[model samples]
Target: MKKILYILVLGGLMSCQKEKETVLKEDIQFLKIKNGLIESSYYENVESIKPIDGFIPNDSTAIRIAETILYKVYGENNIVKQRPYNIALKQDSIWCIQGNLPEGWEGGVFYIELNKNNGKVEKMFHDK
Candidate 1:
């Protein structure tokens, strides 16, 4: 009888755990759907829903993204050497990130042009 009770308790616990997992999965799915709806609304042209704008909305964010890319392409030391990165938004859709060289510097700095709305790297190169 004790063994049977133990088995039943174990089964109940297992079932509850499974239920919790299912609920968690459902919650995650709901959140994804909700977020998708919000994103879709941004793209829609309806009067109620605002038109889609560029994604990398600000200079700070653009700088961070550009730095990350630069770090990957040109090692940390190289990126550090070029301090004070210049970031600008052009035509309301392009993020232009350029590395600034110190005074009397002759080497080329990193330059990256990315799409603000889609975060796509349109062009990337490091000057010599």
Candidate 2:
């Protein structure tokens, strides 16, 4: 009984959560910095890192870009909490980015990338 209890306890601790969080990229990318993961982080299958735009200021002098290291430290789906980050900006375009780092991620360096339409990163990175 004691051994069984120990195994169960360890198993529970090592298990992941199941939650649902959505990042539409277009719908919610306005002056917002998103930092959450989707279903999984599988290569080529990883969630996209897109840009968000908010009501652009009327002044419209220059854009500011920021970046932050993002990580999915816990959760499988139903609920997720990610670290705060900055956005990277250039020219008249704006963007928000989220990417996973290596095993020892304390948060990596992030730069701005423009987001355009439902296109791929390459296509979106240059959209104003």
Candidate 3:
């Protein structure tokens, strides 16, 4: 009976350690950074390293362009928190990404506009 009790306790401890390790690994996989741009999968798939061509704009392409332009104005800390941007392509090949601003800011939602043909930022503004 004594030997059986000791074995059970050891098994439980090992299982607990494994559980902790799994949690840590999961946390690490939640976020990733590339090309000095930090994006996380914890909330949404917000970053795309792959480059696209032509006048078509997908979530990855729009995000990559938007983040690049936004990064110049705001640091990674300010941008990463605004994930899962609401994106749309409007008339004249305009690709726009609208993300929410942090609390206590003057604006509520930030609008980032880009020319789909050349990936050039046309305008960036926010709703007051």
Scored by lDDT, the top model is 1
* Stretches > 4 Å off in candidate 2: 1-82, 94-112, 117-119, 123-128
How far out, in Å, is residue 24 in model 3? 60
Task: Tell me the tens digit of each residue's lDDT in model 1 across 1-128.
Answer: 99999999999999999999999997666446553364454446655433376667788888888888888889989988887888788888999888889999799989999898888899999989
Question: What would the TM-score be for candidate 1 when compared with the true structure?
Answer: 0.58
RMSD of each: 11.0, 22.5, 14.5
The best candidate by TM-score is 1
Candidate 3 to native Cα RMSD, angstroms? 14.5
The global Cα lDDT (0 to 1) of model 1 is 0.83
Model 1 sits at a Cα RMSD from the real structure of 11.0
List residue ranges in candidate 1 displaced over 4 A. Answer: 1-53
Report every candidate's CA lDDT.
0.83, 0.35, 0.74
- What pairs collide in candidate 3? none
Please give, for residues 44-88, the per-residue lDDT of candidate 3 as tens digits. Answer: 745645445555456687888778777778666667767667888
Candidate 2 C-alpha lDDT tens digits along 1-128:
99999999877765522111233443344424436543232335557654464333222211221121112222222111222323344354444443333456464333234433332233112111
The Cα error of candidate 1 at residue 111, in Å, is 0.4
Task: Locate the minimum summed-lDDT window of 10 residues in model 1.
Answer: 34-43
